[model samples]
Target: MSLKKLETLSTKLLLKNPYWEYKLDNYTLPGGQTGEYHYVHTPGAAMVIPVHDDGTLVLVKQFRYLWKKESMEFACGGVKDGDFLSTAKNELSEEAQLAARDLRQVGEFNPFNGATDEICRVYLATGLSKATRERDASEEFEVLRMSVAEFEDLAGKGTIWDGMTLAGWMLARRSVSALLKEKRL
Candidate 1:
């Protein structure tokens, strides 16, 4: 096995439009070999772990076009032209119709490894209260509240899918336990 050095990376537009764009690139490898590839990239996004004081989590049930089915997933949405925290908060409200007083960054994840560039920021949201859910016209999702035990059960039972959501839940589970302990004292 050998390590590769990127001598150069040049980007070219394969498909250009206002809605979306596709790009092509050529990179020089370590052995002086140039490789060409095409990529379809999109802006980064954010996901939220909306937890209640009682160790409950807010999940959304929506139709995933890629999977061609509905899945029980955590609150997540695209990062618009705003701060990451604002994106998380907005997603919590829009997707779950809930808000939290205490919000913290859990972690970030990159789902694709081959060509596409997609980064999703995950956040932990607690101290939840009811709020208005102003969903976008394209957004048709339903919110559900479940206990942490239920989530754990779902995870074990193979119900809670979505790798990003699972990763965020794992981190938030530990953090929220400590947070709850601190609140108790």
Candidate 2:
């Protein structure tokens, strides 16, 4: 049997907040069955992999209230008004206290396709320097710099478990390796 796409009959707003909207969608399945689906709708997000001159990565260790534990991840933030690069740069500065002279978009991914309509654009930021922007008042995180190998080791051992960070790294690691090999970054 061939599968078909779902047809959304209607969407109801269950809740709305500054960050996202909880939605209840009524749809007709390919099998001619009607059902209700709940999901989150968002304006999307951006994540930055900040690589230093020596090929080290700048990450942030922050407490995740939902998870109730500290997590380490690449600088990331939600896109505002559909500006991906600006959000990436702002997030880099805000989360890691660094600015990039060159920022290249590596790739994009949907972190939680089953639950949300949030696509995250990933960027590779090189030519880094310290940024002097004030951190967000509600944000508290520690910036960390580590070699690529060390980062891989930590990731391998499951120390770094942020889905966005892992997804961004998967998209940008090859470009990072190529730049390092060519001494371009």
**The candidate that achieves the highest TM-score relative to the unseen native structure:** 2
List where candidate 2 sits over 4 angstroms from the true fold. none
Models 1 onward score TM values of: 0.87, 0.96
Could you give candidate 2's per-residue lDDT for residues 1-185 as a string of tens digits?
97678999999999999889999999998888999999999999999999888888999999999999999999999887899999999999999999999999999999998999999999999999989678888889899999889999999999999988999999999999998888854
lDDT (tens digit, per residue) of candidate 1 on 1-185 = 87756765898989965434688889998778898877766677788888777767789998888988888888887665747788888988888998889888978877665766777788989888887867888778888888777888998888878777787777677777787677672
Residue 73 shift from truth in candidate 2, angstroms? 0.5
List per-prediction Cα lDDT, in the order shown: 0.80, 0.93
